[model samples]
Target: MSLLSPALRRSPAAASTSVTAAGGADALPLRFAAVGRSFGTGPRARAVLRDIDLALAPGEVVALLGPSGCGKSTLLRGAAGLDTPTTGRVLIDDTPVRAYDERCAVAFQEPRLLPWRTLRANVALGLPAGTERRTGASRVQELLELVGLADQADLRPREVSGGMAQRTSLARALARRPGVLLLDEPFGALDALTRLKMQDLLLAVHRGSPTTVLLVTHDVDEALQLADRIVVLGRSGEDPAASVSQLVPVPGARPRDRGSVELAALRSRLLESLGVDAHRH
Candidate 1:
């Protein structure tokens, strides 16, 4: 029996040479080449993504937006090497990503922190294997300070507010010093006000340690505010599979006016692509 599934064996990427993930750069470009994913087999097979091609420049932040079940998170999982694409490939700075690639770190909708660990210990959990104790401690401290959790480092997950716990999660991911940060609705669980604050915190985090960021989100406004480009995933016409339906660039620099006329126009276009009437309440 072949090591690869039949679908992967048919992919050009399947033959790629394996390489170790590294801190080759502070930020690494990510590419998805003709990526597709499906589950099950035979008549039970279901396709979630198809022909999804996207590229992120080093230090660029891109947001994936789509209707529920459009495979936004699936695409992100592929990049992180948490799941393999049925076809095509995911490349990081020209090298194929290995399984459980250390070059990338992921934070999901839930903080997923260990309840018993203090915020500091949770962040320390992401340090690379063999990291020197002193250096790791310094890095953890730096990240806690970066995420505004320095004052609460002793608190366990249960003691902190949801937003604080989420910040701790972000800090942990950053501790790995990954070239790519994959966030799947990291702020989706927070209340509106907390979500807004977290967004700003993320921007600050990016500035302090710029890396390629791939964010999967449902909020059009959040995409406009955080992404350098917004890739709308949806099916076209009769095709029931989702792909990059719209790759819209978010113009202007960071700290954009949330109510900017330009952003509003882009938001409307994105919402309409997802089958929502931009004019509807």
Candidate 2:
């Protein structure tokens, strides 16, 4: 059961739409209209986000980038239905998210696996009850293998390395077959080498499954490596006035070479956006 087998690493072009209901033409996946969120009230009120209009077709990967207090994670949480917006709307296939649903899945900064569950079982947890046990098990195994963790299937999260545990979390997300995948800094805690490897693995998994992915991260390099479009957020005044700056598209192809001129230019541009001197380390 090699993790990176051809079966698990199939071409992205062959991916099927996962969360579409049994209906007409899949309804264009997801849409967000003037999405906004706020907190507090009057003089104490704060706007965490505003004017967020975006649409995600099936198979798209968008990144949210910004400083610490900006609303990247808040926006993602709104989309995931984990947090309610004080204003505006978040929609998946035209339906509003008020609670958990099978159409979307989230992977947080931590793997969040139950310590008592093995890697395989954690993934199987996403399956519907009454799913044929063997079928659910097979799907979990397939996803584990896809994320390069098949051999670690029987291990509990505590027994695995952090990177390996995160891969298990990713497998769990994929097992749900959600059309929309929300990732909040899924690789932010990994070591440099492991982060790079996880980046590649994520790209490969996205390719294989082609879900609509929204990733929130502070790491500009990670955004460049994985996002088709990067949205930057910034704080306007002090506590009560933060907002999203702009959405910039990362125009390129898959397996984008880090050293290529186009990628280097993108990296430089993103660094500039962050007000970091590109020439500085």
Candidate 3:
């Protein structure tokens, strides 16, 4: 559920995600209906995903987890309309997604910033196609402040640390004021301390903005810390394609204790589901 443009916008009254304080413009729901994706044709055909059905409630934060190469990114691409599903469809609220959906914004693992642009200018690139100059500038400034990049707004990509660049990427995505903020391993490259700080910052961002978020992450603890629910994807037995294997709703509340005993138990269970030995790993 990622990437934004000038697409669908919904009323705050319709939003149900309460991970933070609600905002003026709330989130829209996203649904994957019997979706399937395959590559090649005839004898060469290989399915990566089949019958992937998941619904994200308005304003909720859901994290996607799966084994490597289990089509996690592929499914996300389908929702973003960067790639089409071979069957079924992805819908935002009641509308089917079009190419490069404007209702969502994606912050990938890489910052993907243009070296020639200042951080402010990079963020401004996400403004809607028809936005007035003044309004867009204001929005970009607000996002820079939101992501704690206001002081460095004048810097270029080469001038900042990796974490700073990632923050800029987040600010750029939010510049679209997307209904659904899609995060694809956005903190995977950072150091442990930086990653933790970015997680806290994300919560702050959600508290201030109150948009629906669909995050795709490989970290089990990350899923436990931030998500309202964790949806696990995996193949069953010898099945070639992956489908939903578990839908575990996270317990407790936001800003959860990182070392909670309950979370530890859940983490072990999740690791086991992914075929890792809890004690050995």
Best by lDDT: 1
For candidate 1, the per-residue lDDT at 196 reads 99
* Candidate 1, superposed: residue stretches over 4 Å from native: 1-25
Q: What lDDT score goes with residue 14 in model 3? A: 38
Q: Point out the worst 10-residue segment of candidate 2 by lDDT.
A: 19-28
Q: Which stretches of candidate 3 lie over 4 Å from their true place?
A: 1-23
- TM-score of candidate 2 on Cα atoms, chains taken together: 0.86
What's model 3's overall lDDT? Answer: 0.84
> Each prediction's TM-score against the native?
0.90, 0.86, 0.91
What tens-digit string does per-residue lDDT give for candidate 3 at 1-281?
21121121222223334233343455778888899999999999999898988887776788999999999999888878789999989988768988999988999999999999999999999887998999888889888988988999999999999999999999888887788788999999999899999999998888788778889999998999888889999998898999999988777778899999999999999999999898875
Q: Per-residue lDDT for 50-166 in model 2, tens only?
A: 777766655567788887877888888888888887777887867787667567789998999999989888888877568797878878877887998888899999999999999
Q: Who is ahead in lDDT, 1 or 2?
A: 1
lDDT of each: 0.85, 0.76, 0.84
Give me the displacement of residue 265 in model 2, in angstroms: 2.0
Candidate 1 — number of clashing residue pairs?
0
Count backbone clashes in candidate 3. Answer: 5
RMSD of 3: 5.3
